[model samples]
Target: MAGHSKWANIQHRKGRQDEKRQRVWTRVSREIMVAARTGGGDPGANPRLRLAIEKAKAANMPLTNVNHAIAKATGTLEGMSYEEVRYEGYGIGGAAIIVDCMTDNKVRTVAEVRHAFLKHGGNMGTEGSVAFQFKHCGQLIFAPGTSEDRVMEVALEAGAEDVITDDDGAIEVLTAFADFESVKKALEAAGLTAEVANVTMRADNSIELTGDDAERMQKLLDVLEDLDDTQDLFHNAAL
Candidate 1:
């Protein structure tokens, strides 16, 4: 594709996780807890919780652990409370970066995030500084060789916003954040399985980095991702 589809990003990110051996379960657990606490514990009734459960399954998280996280969040068992936070910043080459976090301590999270940015040739920005460059949306990507016509038919019929076939033949389906779950279910019912599906911050444009700039920007992203409270990260850097 354009090397920027949801599928490509997932593959690249998974490759990085393989090399780093990061504890993805920790982040997934926080997501489940937050989703359950904010919406009811019932995945069938809560789109956010359903998405969290899907992510946990995709990660191969233990069923018991997932259940326990839900129980804790729903007050069936005790669990640490977390709040969602977003940090915007500028990276090397002036790339826009957005860090998503789930933390119990806002002060600690902010300091840790700020330190990572400063240490890696980046600087944190005020809230909303870089946020306007992104649009919150649900994305689904099918691999090359998928039936573009079928995807478009099903996606459009299910209330999707648009269907795009990238240069690499990957099919990308976009939908409003609110319709994500329903659209996903409809796609599955139509026997269409996406290689990657999730709600994400989509950048309107990207800043291509090369050579030393690319290296430095990657280092900054890695440092930010390694932070304990970090949940999800998005950036406008096209490596």
Candidate 2:
């Protein structure tokens, strides 16, 4: 598994405290809106929107809130227009980093991102500079108690690319981006629940970090993720 996926698992294991829940919901909502807008509001027809709705439900967001977001996306209500942007860079230890963002103001977002990198001992690079070091894939993380053999059987039957079992008993199923929805549905039909199901960037290689470099790198990632405009952050740092 990539470092980003491992880091996400670590965060999940910690569970959500009250303070982080609000911010997390905000980001999830944005993602839902974007998916609905791009692919239409019908979950039956829009795979991305379907996954977003599932995530919103898992987060316990109100049905009214979900409907309103869909309305905004479908133009029933006015909403701020957001553009999806990606930033590639290098963090401490020369770890390749990729940031995915949704912003109303590109200028402000880029400036803030650049500042964050500079402050954290990193620098932003051109669009393709670090993106080449990563591969886009669909990942579904199952909670503890999920059976590895069973999960693998269902996922592989659904066209998954790989299934990885971690020492902590968390199972990660990887699939082609286009096969994500089918694989997720197969798992659900087999009575397996996924803690997280989304399309994410996976690093092709990782840079090992220790001591001060590791600490500072984590701080940089925390700062980036805390930004409201930032949607997803990926890095090639090996924990």
Candidate 3:
């Protein structure tokens, strides 16, 4: 399994958003704006935009705010333009870490990201250094007690790459990034809901951190996540 979903990294990142309060909305808005500007304002025609909108909906974001974000992105209203940037690095115990950000100021974003790494017992790597350790895919996890047969039937029939049920009975559906939206719609239409759904860079392997290493790794991840430009983060550490 390469420990892809064992730690449920994306879900953990979302869970921790509660600590930052409004930062989740800010990150979601940035994603929405970027997706809109790049793919146009129509969610129907824009997969990325549609995915962003879905996340917004799941977060209970206001419709007015979603519309405002789209408008600003499409230039119907004024707003700062943002560009996506990624940083890869080695964290405590040499765990692979990837930080995703959207920023209008590349210099500031770079500095903030670099500073966090250096200050937290880590160092940034050149582009692609740690990226090869991950796969860019869509993941959907269902609750432990969800009907495994139902999930497998719908997800597999709808173009899922694989359906895996963990030892504890949780179901995970994997799909190619491009097929994510369609597969998700199919599952939901069949009355199946995922507990965690997103397109993410899942780790290929894991580094089990314990004691001092685990504590340090958590601190480093927290620092990187707290940066204003950070949109999404991934790591191989099982803390």
TM-score of each: 0.92, 0.90, 0.93
lDDT of 2 at 197: 78
lDDT of each: 0.89, 0.83, 0.89
Clashes of each: 1, 0, 0
- Candidate 1's displacement at residue 109, Å, is 1.1
| Whole-model alpha-carbon lDDT for candidate 3 | 0.89
Per residue, candidate 1 scores C-alpha lDDT tens digits across 141-173 of 888899999999999999999888876688888
Q: What is the lDDT of residue 169 in candidate 3?
A: 67
Enumerate residue pairs that collide in model 1: 1-168
lDDT value for model 1:
0.89
For candidate 1, the TM-score is 0.92
lDDT of 2 by residue, 104-123 (tens): 99999999899999999999
